[model samples]
Target: MKNLNKLYILLFAVLVFATSCEDLTEINEDPNRPTEVPVEYLLTSAERQLGNRLYGGFDNVAFGMTVSQYWAQNEYSDETRYQFRANTNNTFWSDFYTAINDLQEIKKVNTTIDKGQQGINQNAVATILQSWAYHSMVDIYGDIPFEEALQGVDIPSPAYSDQELIYSALIDSVSSAVAAIDPSAPGFPGGDVIFDGDLSKWQKFGNSLLLRIGIRLSDVNPSLAEQTISAAAEGAMKSNADNAAIQYITAQPNVNPLYVSYVVNGRQDYCATENFIELLNGLGDPRIGEYFVPAANTGTFEGLPYGVTSAVAAGISRDAVSQLNPQVYAADFPGTLMGFVETSFILAEAASNGWIGGSAADYYAQAITASMNYWNITDGNAIGDYIAANPYTEDNLKVQKYIAMYYEGWQSWAEIRRLDLESLPAANLVEIDPAVNFVDVSNILNRRLYPQDEQNLNGANYQNAASNIGSDAYDTNLFWDLD
Candidate 1:
């Protein structure tokens, strides 16, 4: 009887121990946090972050809009007057790097979990996005971490890469990515927000981006530029349907950047600049009404002069200056990354340079027509008349390009620098208030200064880059900016 009772006790103890062990394991697992996230979720997050960085934030409002002279602040004109802050600079740098990191992770996971053609398709998309993010950073800062970037624990302090070398790598990466994508392959169906898993559109986007990079190197390496542009022109974006854009939802977190900035924040800081308005109005461009609302008091479109002092701006009535159109600030407005119109313009430039087969004038007219249509100016006669009035001269090409790039502030600023659009800044400065004579209008910023954190954290590499690029100043011209 004693032996049987001991056996029973042992059996009970074993059961209790097993149950407790299972409970312990369950408790150790966290429901609130995830060790690994789906690559689809990561892609969505990256797209949203990129949109926020490009379309919203101080970087867009202060540096992009101000430098482009598309919009000017009612007060606190430091950013508009070419005064950059370290905090703002750091924000732009960090945000883009974060998005790039997310893209890299997607590539890693897609390689691990997916195989064959599907894996190739996923990786190609990630590579294209990574290329774009890197290009934006390189264009803004001149030199940045490229080869060793997004290495996680492997490279805590990556060295800065040369801008020219970085551009070359980006061009190659994008070209390879475009080639790797197979439209027939199975795609990660829900992952793509921009094109909804359409591999062909992604291919077109990559090719269009290639064209942009190719043209960007025209002045520095004309032969390579010509070769690259010719190849890209064969498969680039064909029409507005292929434009790379992020469509925002009319909801809390997914609202458009302009809506978050203007509506949710209730900030009336930015108004259309006279520089932009005058250019459109002078050309009788129909996009003027589409881009801005008529002033509240005057019941007509008016704009504040760019780079004005606070006192000069204060004298003007706020109600008389044109604010951005409400439609642009709508929650569902799509945030454009690259557009078909831009591709058309690039083709026009390539034609003019004799790098491609098309007639420059025909490409120019197509580009203007595309731009007008993009802004909802669908009238055939109106577009034809505008095209007729504005001939395909080099000046007209540059001017129309500038006008077409209304809300695309950073690109506009870069294009002005690359093309040396003398009239853009020159004509605007002539109208500057005499009382606001402190700023040297002749020395407009060519590039943004490196964030102060780079100096502190990556001291040696930062110093080397600064030395290579000439003082890390805003006035320093990038390698491609011959002007």
Candidate 2:
């Protein structure tokens, strides 16, 4: 099953049309047209693409699955693949700006969609989606083309805005949009790829997204965090059923975005990481069955040992081992596509720390239990029981969170970069000797350097972006990662 479809995004680059003044003038051109091409279509398209692969450098799947603490650390040569770096092959900024342009176009006529029956909710949904795009864009590339971004033809050569501004905007935008959702609205879109366009569900999505943004600001702004979590708890997801995940069709050109490369194309390239697998297995957790292929025909589930060395990598056979593969991917696999579980987990952490006034352990247990139930593995076991039976030490929390975050994006890696989770039973191939570095923390890699294109397409600007953050490659940390 080892083949080559994952390279599609790596090899293909989208040709964005030059923006014309008219194109940027309107966000939605039509009020009622099934399959109608609207200016604001880009919002939906970009949100969906968040699940799809854009380029070699910005794959949420690979980064979340392989690089982050949730999964394996590469046995290959470069940790560049494990963390964020300016990749020569990635075009995330271009993709984001293009989407931004589309969003702006839709915003121009966004009010048109606010007709009698279900106008308010429709507008709110659109706003919520746009907020998601902005958050995602700046999270990957700090200080991106914001403010002037998504302005369509308004500003062709949009200037980069500080990442901080983008984050701040998301907080306000998502908050306001959520407040506007008319849950009782009768008229909503007929076809929704995610959440079936249910206004209530959209409200939950908006609230959950708010919770995510709140947590992102925890270390930097505790006051904001406390306030935001309080609001998040009022409307965020209550169960796995309320998740804001999009369901990709398995139909041609519509299959689960990951399917095109990992399954149908015949290339079983990516697999579960040893670090991810070991932690779950050690806890006697059941999610392994849902996430990985049980070692294959011979029937052994091979869970790899984490932080294995190059020599150790050679020792593990690929036979029916405990590992995850895309082919065996289930419909309900604990997913990275934002959901109630993640939102709950964030709230749980907030409450636990007293950053907000709620039960931390209660939220934590709910998050974990909901996640387990998501995999259809409800065996009468509760998350509290599991945590109590097991040691709720720092390491356990790290590993548990890692397991909970499978298939999520670089957030887990961010957690590792910022917080020193009690050590895992794994080894790190530290580039700099701990003794010589003289730094308190041993060997830790932060932000990824600018990809090759920085020196090519946007050379001067890339250098500035790199310098702003301190490093253009993987060795440097982001402004937010400062502990």
Candidate 3:
């Protein structure tokens, strides 16, 4: 009986060893998860994710609108008050990284799987997007993971690159991307949500982006700025038709981010800010109704004071404050990444700096006309009148730029900060309700704080970045913001 038991145990051990030695990798693999996806699908996903990050409600309302003084919170005023919850930064950081990772994957697949002249075209598109994602990060956080970012399992803790260096690399990347495009080569038509696989438009968009970045360095690195601006102006966006924008559908997942925030979430948290509305109203801007709705109670436009406390906000009737235009808040409204209006403004600024050819006034007029056209303000007389009323004064240029970037809160805030607009005060211009606690009226926030996760997951890098920037406070100025 003992011998028989030993034999059975020995057979069982051999069976277990054989089973473990066999290729169980395939059996253990999850059927649902894909090891690789089509490049076109990845491209489409990257574009959608980028749009969501850029135009999403959380960033727009919670940070951008309040900082830019374009919109104010009706009830939850913590963000406006600059008392940001930890999760706010975390969410933004995560979303951006997710998009960045996908973009990186697109580049990888383009190089490895689709290597050819056709692959070069696709790779160029991916490279431009990667540049854009990195540029946006640098703009917001000053310095971020650029050199070794998206390395996956290879390098988990990528060191932060200097913002100046990142800007240089981004400019080179965009330039190379534009140069590498082969129009005759096959392209991912279905994947391109912005330009419909038009390599020419993509090149134009890259040049436009270059113009933006070049001008960004105008205050800090004037020589490089002049050179870059001059070069980019040669191929930058020429017309409103060439604008880089993403059109959203009426479907649930693909709906406009504003619609998701306002309708799906059932929240009326945002109202037009008194600062922005007063500026537009003062200018008699024809796009007022296109941007905001009339107050429900008075049937006239009214704006809420920005950065007010919850208690102060609670006292105001919701219907008395102007909400976003219904058209803007609709699910199908197109989200703009870059437009000719913005490019024109960049040209105007460059001309003012003597970095590019053409009269500043001409570019300024073109910008206004483009903006009007973008908003569907086709009344020729109205546009002509508005253009005549607003000339190319420096102050007027900055103000108009601010107004043109209404839905694009981040860009507006960046412009406001870059220009150091003394006219539009975020904190001290209009006195907040005395009842509002935690209001820091002394300092204006210039940049968003680094993500809190950086402190925990990447403590050493976080400390270095914070020290390099002088402080981790939202009031710290970026390198390019040296006025």
Report the Cα RMSD per candidate. Answer: 3.5, 13.0, 3.7
Candidate models: Cα lDDT each: 0.84, 0.59, 0.83
- Tens-digit lDDT track of model 3 for 208-271: 9999999889888999999888998989999999988887899989888888988898886888
Model 3 lDDT-worst window of ten: 425-434
User: Candidate 1: where is the Cα deviation over 4 Å?
Assistant: 1-34, 423-441
Task: Name model 3 segments beyond 4 Å from true.
Answer: 1-34, 423-443
Q: Which TM-score value belongs to model 3?
A: 0.91
Residue 350 in candidate 3, Cα distance off native in Å: 1.1
Worst 10 residues of 2 by lDDT: 74-83
| Candidate 1 per-residue C-alpha lDDT over 150-202 given as tens digits, one digit per residue, 9 for 90 to 100 | 88788888888999999999889999999999999976668677888899999
The CA lDDT at 62 in model 1 is 73
Best of the candidates, TM-score? 1
